[model samples]
Target: MEFFGMNKRKIIAIADPYSTGHHLSYNKLLVEAARRNDFKVVYISDRIGCKYINEIFPDTDIFINEIGISNSKISREVKKIVFYIRAFQYCRRRDIACLHIAYIDRSIFSIALANSAIKIDKLLITLHWNYFSSPENNSLINRLETKIFSWLSRGSVNTNVHSGLIVDDLYIHNIKSKYTPYPIAVLPSITSHEENKLSCDGEIDALVTLIRKADVSLLCFGGMRYDKGADLAVHLLESLPEYTHLFIVGKPEYFSKEYLNNLAMSLGVESRMHVYDQYIADDDIQSIFNACSIVCLPYRESFSGQSGPLTIAASLGKPILASNNRFIAFEINNQSIGEVFDSLSFHEVNRAFIKALEKSYSPKEFIEKHDPERFIESIGEMYKVNND
Candidate 1:
């Protein structure tokens, strides 16, 4: 697995908080990139995430550790302090040349603390959101955290973000960052042991059948949250043509399938709506996306990060109908991939969805520009141990 003549410096470690959702695919892509760049990677995540990584790359070394904090204010602060102490110690003991944190939103302050004390050769962080978007985010405590994070970035620490808008925002604050493409979640060619569990799940076939029966099926894929606007998707169904259907795939975070169904029932579109409230396997992603006419993303204004479902939809050549979030709108408009509308306006979204259905999209050019190899190479450059 070693690349000949590749710089054999100290190992590069990647730390991620969560194991589920886009984390699994993102971590896999990162590990592959590190290996390709000739860096020995020590993957660190929770026990479940570690096991999943092991199953994917059995030969690669991995470390099982909890990297996320609790939700409670007091408990979260306490856990962050402990995590910072332990992280610094682990890097010192392992002689880690570079420590790249995959997601630093929740643990930014703790990571800032660790950066000050850790003696690693280099540190890398992926800034996923624009924290300075609101006055609340600029509160005294948050400003302090941002200052520390930016100060550290000028040293051995390198920072990157998936959105160009985030990069620009960081630049405005005198923080330099690289714009890395969000890695496409390539479904595995060979089904994994976990995916095999869903082989006999009748829900997959039922959903596919339901979508195929419709004239035009709208899909809201990936983890469901109130911010993601599943309620808006339901509302759109009521105004669309009678033949239009909606399929919601992925696990719900703060709501239940019954709640969404009830909303659809209230809108009198219950007969045309379908819900699959569970984690979908890699094998099923293609079939599900293929069944849908358009991918809907009506995320609220509070959501400032890139959408995993948007990436998936674009890669699959499925046209998107996304909210006018800075990143999502940029991608759709820049690439001519689909249509965009303000998430707050029900009438706008309704009109935009119909327009998307009628318009033809040629995402092949967009797909070619942001392929997985390009994303991997960008990350590999960031993971370079000898950046001097």
Candidate 2:
């Protein structure tokens, strides 16, 4: 249904505070798009200051504090104590309509606390996994937490009418979502920039220099976490000795530079591969996006349904060679957007990489397909009609 004869409502986003990074930069695109469509966007996070709080949310606000405290406390429980208290206080002060959770724990505690304190409507949550069953949240205490959380979610949904998950891939194991492993709807991240942007002199020099001096031709963007498939990509690239460069942007969750270097050296591609594990700020992003021709994410599972890099590539109109199993494959099912490779075999990936290298995409077509205009319109519809 098209929206007509109406005013855009205020839309607030409650994000999870996981240390800091532009990793959540996708949300910025959503906020911009929403505002352009006439909805007020209010973003909240405790990592940013009171200035940010004031800037993001002048009236009804939402925030959480999960950083600053060392994990070296008497118990892991101590850290959570602070997070819940801060989140609850923020909700109470703002008269929040909904709590948009970034993770399961954040949902469980914040919803539990919010429900305890006041009448919060539209309590929606996002899940980070497909119901396809992996080594995801099945710990004993986590199970108990999930059961309680699901109970709260059902209650909230009944009351509020507004809720979402980035992707809805529950029922993979026949387990209900009242707990940690349940599927949430998809709410993807985005990446955007000005139009008609061509490669700058310095960016051209950097890519040319890499091509001339080093053998790097590929880029794996994002944290080198275990599930993120960094080592797997490394292994696959090791087999493709002809493909000289696999430039990894971002730091590793566990392995250090020395360890990754050793892996490259052992694979005999150390001379060709490069690792820029330093922090890449928001201002440097446009150049970074322009530097690479393709963005590769070969994960064993989907990001529940969020893909910051994938969405960025789609927006920037760069080809993406990703794993077929992820939820994004359903949306980005074409060569220009990039194709999926086998997560199991190096041979499968080698062929996929060859095809991906042969292909490129048009920015115009990508923006038309995945532009935030339609989504913001849809979200605006939901915002106005969800509670009514």
Candidate 3:
């Protein structure tokens, strides 16, 4: 008969499911993948409820909730702690085998609350940040994180990292993880309906058609802010006449409107640049990709985290000219990914912009190389093999 027969895994995916962003999409993929292998799955998110614990109670042999968390106010923290404690009680009610918390804030506190609920043999925490690498980070946060990891080691939550660079740094810092120094998986962000909305009429259509036809040489995305390379985007666009339009999307700049208008006037590319100071809906994001000849993210060096937005552009197979910092640059080098450029100097950004306009890369090949199936399969099994 079968030596290793099918196993049952119960996974509780906890994240800020408020938007159709990376975290939520990852959960969906996990559950679906589990189903393919005859494994029971449950997705839990807080994006929908105020329930100290609300549960989706999946149709499978598992349970999940899209959990929302609160760390904003004093009362909110107290209420959240109490709510999380109640969540442990709820997990007990349904027999949650392994809980995977997505965001840092959610994971840290959730682990604290689920202390008694977790069995050392089954506990895991995925490391999504390099607390040591942060520029102005307070020592207190790092200290506490270190202490938390030490505590988590008994159960030893696997720190699934996406890069070998992070793995080495964590080890150098004496932090612990369970998988390869690199993250175990790389699930590129997907636009829920990014394609459908791109084809819609009105403002979105006009902008897309105009930009695509004109085929602008340089386009900078992310918010039009200094940190996100707003000024650099403008500076580079002005430096190169071939670089036509810079599609400035995401949250508005410091002001409502005039900052961008003024920035354009200052750069003298006001007429060439088009700014949409609004949140690009998940379904409508493809327009951002389709409208630009190349996507650029000139992020300043910091220990913030991975660039989900930049990664999104890369996955779609567009030519992405990105900051040449450690995380972004390493991603390009290790994965054979995109066009990595020096973000510190405007001259470098200008040169990279020009190069991107003339280049095209295999988006499909990038995905093939990253190969999300292993990542997806393991997560799926994580839920299926655990006994509730």
Candidate number achieving the greatest TM-score relative to the actual structure: 1
How far residue 131's Cα lies from its native spot in candidate 3, in Å, is 4.6
| Ranked by TM-score, top first | 1, 3, 2
Better of 2 and 3 by TM-score: 3
Instruction: Estimate every model's Cα lDDT from 0 to 1.
Output: 0.73, 0.53, 0.56
lDDT of 1 at 274: 87
Question: How accurate locally is residue 157 in candidate 2, as Cα lDDT from 0 to 100?
Answer: 46
Q: In candidate 1, what residue range of length 10 has the lowest lDDT sum?
A: 188-197
Task: Assess every candidate by TM-score.
Answer: 0.86, 0.72, 0.76
Weakest 10 consecutive residues, lDDT, candidate 2?
A: 158-167
Q: For candidate 2, lDDT tens digit of each residue in 58-165?
A: 642334454455656444445555565565456445554545544443345545665566545655454543322323546675565555545665654422111123
Tens digits of per-residue lDDT for model 1, 90-180: 7667666677788887677677777667667777888776664323356786677667767767766677777776766666667654445
How many clashes show up in model 1? Answer: 0
**Model 3 stretches astray by more than 4 angstroms:** 1-17, 47-83, 105-110, 113-121, 131-138, 180-201, 213-219, 222-227, 252-262, 343-346, 381-388
The TM-score that candidate 3 achieves is: 0.76
lDDT (10s digit) by residue, model 3, range 277-381: 765654556665766777767666653456666666767767777776677777766665567776446576667766776676666655554456766766655
